[model samples]
Target: MGGSTSASPCSSYQPSPSTVPFQRPPSRFKDINKNHVRLDLNSMVSTLVSDLGSVDINLKKQRSGLLKKHRDSQYRLVELQLVVRFPCFTMTGTPPSLFTMPPRRRANSVRCGKATQVSGETHRVTEKNGNDSLDICRVLNGMWQTSGGWDRIDRDDAVEAMLRYADAGLSTFDMADHYGPAEDLYGIFINRVRQERPPEYLEKVRGLTKWVPPPVKMTSSFVRDSVNVSRKRMDVASLDMLQFHWWDYANTGYLDALKHLTDLKEGKIKTVALTNFDTERLQIILENEIPVVSNQVQHSIVDMRSQQKMAELCQLTGVKLITYGTVMGGLLSEKFLDTNLNIPFAGPPLNTPSLQKYKRMVDAWGGWSLFQALLQTLKGIATKHGVSIATRCR
Candidate 1:
């Protein structure tokens, strides 16, 4: 970040507003050609190529074990400042800075039209308008990094980290209703930014919260109460966005829930959205005229299932995709490039069931060897582009 470059907005490349129509390949997600839905996914290999408990044991150990050799000393694998890394990664062709081009604006990263990057692919999601948002760094500032398993996290430090990310113009946070104290932490973060940063800076940070209630015959009151609870927890009079996730697809009550969400959106409770919703469900929702602006899901190069019909539906419906697991829990980094990922769960603490769940997704996509090959290819691409594998291509 200290590297200096020409201090001017890059005019080198402008995305053809037409590129917004970029459609993903069909049959990329669930098309089964004799069970050969190989995505040729190119990123972290160690993640997909391992046993479970041991790879995770080192990462999941207590703090004492990581520091002390005491037999009883538990490794505080969770406490260590864990990082996501990839091997054989190098991307020199990237621009000196980052400017994401997203279709929405978040609340915390109030900076609109500001250039930001992870591996330096220039994108500007926020233009002069306040409605447009920036692409959240594919690798978000995971709160689970702090609050996931720790007995307690320092509130001030947590807030400071959030501010640092916001100050740097990285918005688009992915959180859920059940994450430990997540709503409260995000609320404090927003309040702190409002109190500390300039008014203009307050407009860029956008925090997206989720509502994963059990599938029920949702009532208007029920949905509104959920939205109201999040609003109170986030300390905001109006929510930037509220995504709903349903555990059961069979229950018809989901529609009722959405109707209430739509009402709340009209009432300024939130910018309505969905999470972990499959293409089929999304299509049904759209057909029913539910106005959703985005879909949060387990998307990554290795997991290209979304590229099939899901991405197309989004393109048609004007909803964008906020992808998590893009880096496969940091398994797409330099450290595991050529290494045999036969270890137990050597990965870091991934808070949501997503970490464990997605691992299964990877296995279904392809066995370990195929994943390794994919990472090698992405590594080659990253090296040519000039950025860290995790950032450049992760």
Candidate 2:
């Protein structure tokens, strides 16, 4: 960000869409691997359409059950429209000038096609440490897909995809300890950046990971060892940010863990944050002076629970809100607008885990009829601006 380049990183490279399918080894075809099922992205989508019953069953066993448990209230009763719009980024790529949070509350304006630069605005989520600070990208590339259950991931292909995203001016990545191979993939991707890309490019790239340990003893040694494991997997000297998640809030081990995380920030950690932490617990965390920079939560048009109680606390404490589920797992897109899910082959199937989960959110927010009306409104707005509903939602 300090140095100016004649050519923006995105200006030089336009990543071509990868049409090459992952090739499995011939040895895998042997009797030893006869039961091995290899499903690509397309096949996964098709499977979701064909086998809704099985998908429903698997959705019950989602890995992020604790997060779901906390966010279940989002669907209780549908609230009126949200008056203000908060900052969000697309999963695809965001412009260089667009950082996390803009100082001013800008209107929900839309621009078609290419990214429009918001000149003279410093939109970043700052994690202050005395004089030093870490400026994170407004939209983070969530790597939960790398966790598993989606499809088979080729390591080289996945790393290439990461590089393309970084080259497109999207460098911030979010992952977690429980998300299998996410940290490992970030490690590989960052190394590739260091070796292949410009030095400044690596500077812009940030990897923020999470630590979701069970309700266990939060000993100094245990915490240190756990953080060290992530560091090693990420191949970084010090972690950019280590977000903490606690399953059973009744167990006061969360406070101990955050305290240990705060202590580690002096050396092994740069910033300590929280994931899916509600308002009351966050207030307690602040009262204890845990020094949390931000709280990552589910804040979307459909789910405005974060804006109700949490916004006041965050505003007062100067803690930023990093939101996920901004697009409702692609339900906000034109693919589902005006389509009927009641008919067997009418609308696009809720195939992916995100779609399946967020569909439930839609159901809780209101029935399909209400959601269709909301989608219709969004489509109208997007049409007026000459952009897709997905872009408008983002």
Candidate 3:
């Protein structure tokens, strides 16, 4: 909503897609521990190469094609044979820029040895053979605020804010076509990365955007045109990741759309994932032989639905779960701890879209009283750890 898309802001160039090699983890791992994720380069090479043939044929081909493009590069085969793993969080050949940030200025942020830092926090980054292969920070910057209702967003200011986040090692960004000016801002930001930052910085910044289309006949041309528009707006030869959202399941056109999206993985998109899809629909997609790498869903402490059915399916099928709303749109913070909003004008108003949306969720999850108790408990834990509730959320 803050930039122009009359023309591409920057020229598109092909960046070699990188993959991480991973084996399936035990199903008992309910949560990902960022500090413990490490890759065993030696073990990963042979196992990943051997496991390639037995996995999803389409994904194998995709990884094979990406690998061929980087055959000549000095990319090492990294083994993500960690104890706690997510199906979607694995990697193969390491990108040169991903782990090579300078130590002096970035010593606190980029720990190339154990884990990659993300905004002073660490997240587990892994990949599965059947899932998406691209690398990203576990904590993503959701750009829904760009759609509207926040404030008048200055284009230069928005781009500068993005640069600050990337520079802080919080490089993975999540946006959508409907999020006005988000793709445009990303286009300008990425061009700046290409021209100003080092190649490593460019590799670290991932723009994972979503495509939410109406329930129309999902012809190849229709899907291609839609995807091309995002590519043009983002000014990227290939999208880092495309997360698709469909409104209606009765139309059944989502399968066709996903098929076409799967075909476009040749060079147009690095990874294809889903957004707001439930366990049943996800199973249907997987049953139809679609190569969906991850399913982006609303997952937070207050809303644990994804952990119930979706987590089981994902764990069984190796599909990664990309979660959002983990902070309950900031309602989980200390700001809401000792306040009561129901008493006339007594507390901070749930004015923002996110705040209002999650306020209802807080209500349904046993109302403000229970939520306050939960927040108080969390605040106590944060105090014990010498971290704020927001920091604990990160």
Candidate 4:
């Protein structure tokens, strides 16, 4: 799951909401310094994680059905959690300060790319396609960690983390059927939210789960059964979005699978999307009249493949792009910015699965020297803007 096989993009690097192009004002960068940027980065991450832990504790209690008798009382608890968490995540109406930047233009046009203001402070992406469209958070919490290549996660902790992310206005989540325990965790989180929060608040949360099945004979029974399994696991009557992926394009059954999914959209799914599909295949799917809203792909500064042909196809077909690998598995951050170039091979190995996977990408994208140069440029920009390199990348 860690290697690019997941074809996962980082949950960061969402499209900007502003219709007008953003040119960072020169005046804002005049007073920035490295110390200030470092402080802000450390403080921001620490505060987010710290506040999340407290909210997670409370959510764990609610998930355990401790507040069923006093549902009305639990509403205030939910509100408090949201109020505390929202400021940490959203960048609504903020000035061009060190920590805030306008949304970046994506390679492909994203539907509902604009952020809808809810309560003046919170922003959510509201797809403007009549009744079928959904309002979701731009930053979707990627759950591939549950799929593997990461540490073992306790079920309660994972569920609590989902609540933390949801309560923070990061309501949209990305998961797949193959990701072990991910759908189950969302099911638990959604059930807890439904039991504890009011309808309006619960509606703000969106789960964008995926259905990546093996290449097989696409029968109605087969497709329906697969969709039903996810529904049962997520404890939802209708899924917010189902992003389908196929391992082998040689098998033309993917079209049949999508047709069945489209049929089930009447009641089981709100939107149908694709994952890891190239331009030609995507065009073929659209030509067949399958209503795919978006295509998820591996997109980052390091990997600009999507911008070449996929962006044009997406622009023509009205399919928005949901990109991952935007942060290049954390390589675009400050930790590696000025490290020693010469080291014994195999002495300091790439530790995480993400690191190992993206290292290959770094090599292919002009090797270590050029990558280090890019990182240095990013560091300069971050220092100039008084923000972390990660913030700049996003």
- For each candidate, the alpha-carbon lDDT, in order, equals 0.51, 0.60, 0.60, 0.57
TM-score per candidate: 0.64, 0.73, 0.70, 0.68
lDDT string for model 1 (72-153, tens) is 5432223211123211111111111112223333112321222343323232242111232344343345543332433455
Error of 4 at 215 (Å): 0.7
Ranking by TM-score: 2, 3, 4, 1
lDDT of 4: 0.57
Top candidate, metric TM-score? 2
Give the Cα error of residue 120 in candidate 2, in Å.
11
Q: CA RMSD for every model?
A: 16.9, 13.6, 19.3, 20.1
Query: Worst ten-residue run, lDDT, model 3?
Result: 42-51
The sequence of per-residue lDDT tens digits that candidate 3 reaches over residues 222-268 is 99988998998899999988988876677899999999998999989
Q: List the residue pairs that clash in candidate 4.
A: 9-324, 9-325, 10-324, 10-325, 16-103
The runs of at least 3 residues in candidate 2 whose Cα sits more than 4 Å from the true structure, single-residue gaps closed, are 1-125, 129-132
- lDDT ranking, best first: 3, 2, 4, 1
Candidate 2 lDDT over 1-394, as tens digits, reads: 1111111011111111211122211211112111111111110000101000111122222212212212223211122232323332222222111213334454334332443341112323455533335777655788766655466667889899888777765567898775667788888888999899889778888989988775788999989988998998889999998988766667989999999888888789988888777777888888987788777766555554555556666766667667776777688878898998988889897666667667776665545766676667666666765677666323
